[model samples]
Target chain A: MEIKETFGLMARHTDDVIVVCALGMSANEWWQVTGSEDTFYMHGAMGFASSFALGLAVAMPDKQVWIIDGDGSLCMNLGTLLTASGQGPANLKHFVLNNGVYQTVGGVPMTGASRSSYTAIAAGAGVERCYTADSMNALSAVLADIKKPGHCFIDLQVERDDGPILAPPQPFEGPEMKYRFGRAMERRFGIEVFGPEGY
Target chain B: MSNPTVHDQLVAALKRCDVGLAASLPDDWITPTLQRLDREPGIAHIRVAREAEAVAAASGAFFAGARSVAVMGATGLFTCLGELATLNLRHQIPLFMLVSERGSRDDHRIYQEVQGRRIKPVLESLDFPYFRITSTADIEELPHAYEWCRMQKRPVIGFLARKLLKG
Candidate 1:
């Protein structure tokens, strides 16, 4: 599915209890999906999100940690996959928006026309389950099937020609949106984001 | 007031800094300090599975925003160098290490004595700032060193000589 469609589906389905770690996407889209008022974004620190997410996921095991990553960003720290799998988290979902380019920094080709195989790599790390979606329909279908208790990767392969989408540039601080995400999810689904399992 | 002992001072400073996690392999020089740290109520002194695991656990504690210190003999400190380079230097994470020095003793027949002598030089080669604590008075820097490490976003090593901990 297209990036926009995947985001819309996530927004609709996410009860807000899931802490979406948004990184390496177009700035505007990243902010919108995260809707995080005050939080750290990689911004320029592309490869570090997964590392941070790994730490956060293990620390806050009760929270459903979702990582919104790009294929290029994943390639930057692929070793993180081994670390992630080493500490199995049933609640973490890793999403890779693979448009075959570093779309934010001038749409540079990432793999020199060679399709990156992240799903295979994730599966090899013992992620339990993995999926790749190259079209909007396939992306929607995968989102419909996100049952937890394992890690999930949705590689959303969009057209390289998708136009530029600009997000706000203000840096966030603290966990205001983290609280909002919890409140939003709790209001809708009666589940605590930072539950008793982790504080 | 001017002097107590290295064991007393390190234990007191670690309590003041609210250090909740500590791990170490045994050593004669650090043995008394380890014993004192073990009796402290606030600190959770853990006997680590290994020095490498101790470093990894310290990184975990740092991420949780807890003050964690790993204690080891001078010999094991050499072995933990790789972990320091990976988790502290490369990642800019702060880890406080207290390494107990070993002096010339008959038991030095083991490989650890050779490693003990090489600790400071290896740390220098890797550019990790270190301090030598020969007397209880030198222990005053413990808290300050921890604060500096947090502020600087790096690791700090305290090399406690045998005389200091023995007293």
Candidate 2:
């Protein structure tokens, strides 16, 4: 299925859930699908969205945290797989958008696209539960199990749409994006993301 | 009773700052502190494979309204400069870090000499504020430093000095 469709299906499950998106395709698609300021649309630090989401999950154990990571982004910091698995945060969900190419830079096929089994890699990295959803039906079939209480990794195989695929990203970035997301979290959760004078 | 060691002092300072979480990639100087943090009931510690993972994770905790810190060596700090600039600098996110201040005149490791010479200059160039904590008194000032980082809305490094760690 298309990246947007995968996001569309996952968007339905986002109530009370925190979404962290890797920069580029994952960020743009999730922003286009959700239009929510609350989810952190990371503008940089290419592969560390999973790390960021894991941190968010550990901090707020009461909330569910999911990261929309792409294949390109995942390769940049595969060591994160080890880090996340070691933390073993039950509230966190790892979702890789596997489109077999660097979809943002122009859909050039990545080196290990055919040979790399991300699910197998995740499992080998000590992730307790791993799933693969290659189609809408497959994703629908596994949503319940994947969403259950435990550390889970889901590799979502998405269509490699021709790049320069111009879906707009979340408009605001830098300090504006920070405050937008921080204030939204404070208001939504009644938590203190900033100090009294507002940092 | 014996005086609290530097590790103990630093952990106490973190507690005083209300820091409840830490993500760390250990350097030898900071390993004992990381081990102590691992057992500290009040602080949730995660051992990351790489330095940038710790930075990103600590950044994540900032949004959850919990104070957090990252611990690594000077070399590890060198590895994550891009993440520091792009994520923390770009977003104006506050991250508190404790790192081993390596490559001092007393430090014999030839490999660490480059890190000692370059780390502070690099931090200076980025305008990412950093403070040196060389004694127990300096450790006491950690809460103040942590608050300053939060107020500045950027990443700050508390470099644990070789004198203190080796003492």
Best by TM-score: 2
Query: Looking at candidate 2, what is the lDDT of residue A54?
Result: 89
Report per-candidate TM-score of chain A alone.
0.75, 0.96
Regions more than 4 Å wrong, model 2: none
Q: Judged by DockQ, which candidate is best?
A: 2
TM-scores for all predictions: 0.55, 0.98
> What is the RMSD of candidate 1?
9.4
Residues B1-167, model 1: lDDT tens digits: 57755577788888877787675667766778789887887775555434654565455445434577878877777766765775466555667888876533423546666775566778889888878777756787788888766655556887776666654
Per model, state how many residue pairs clash: 4, 0
True contacts kept of each: 0.02, 0.89
Clashing pairs in 1: A1-A135, A1-A136, A15-A185, A28-A167
Give the runs in model 1 whose Cα sits over 4 Å from its true position: A16-27, A38-40, A162-165, A170-199, B1-167
What is the Å distance of residue A114 in model 2 from its true position? 0.8
lDDT of 1 by residue, A1-199 (tens): 4566667666665564343343546334656665643233443344545555544455446666667777777776676666566666676678877777777666777874374478888888777678888766776677767655676766667667444435454354323332343345445545443335422
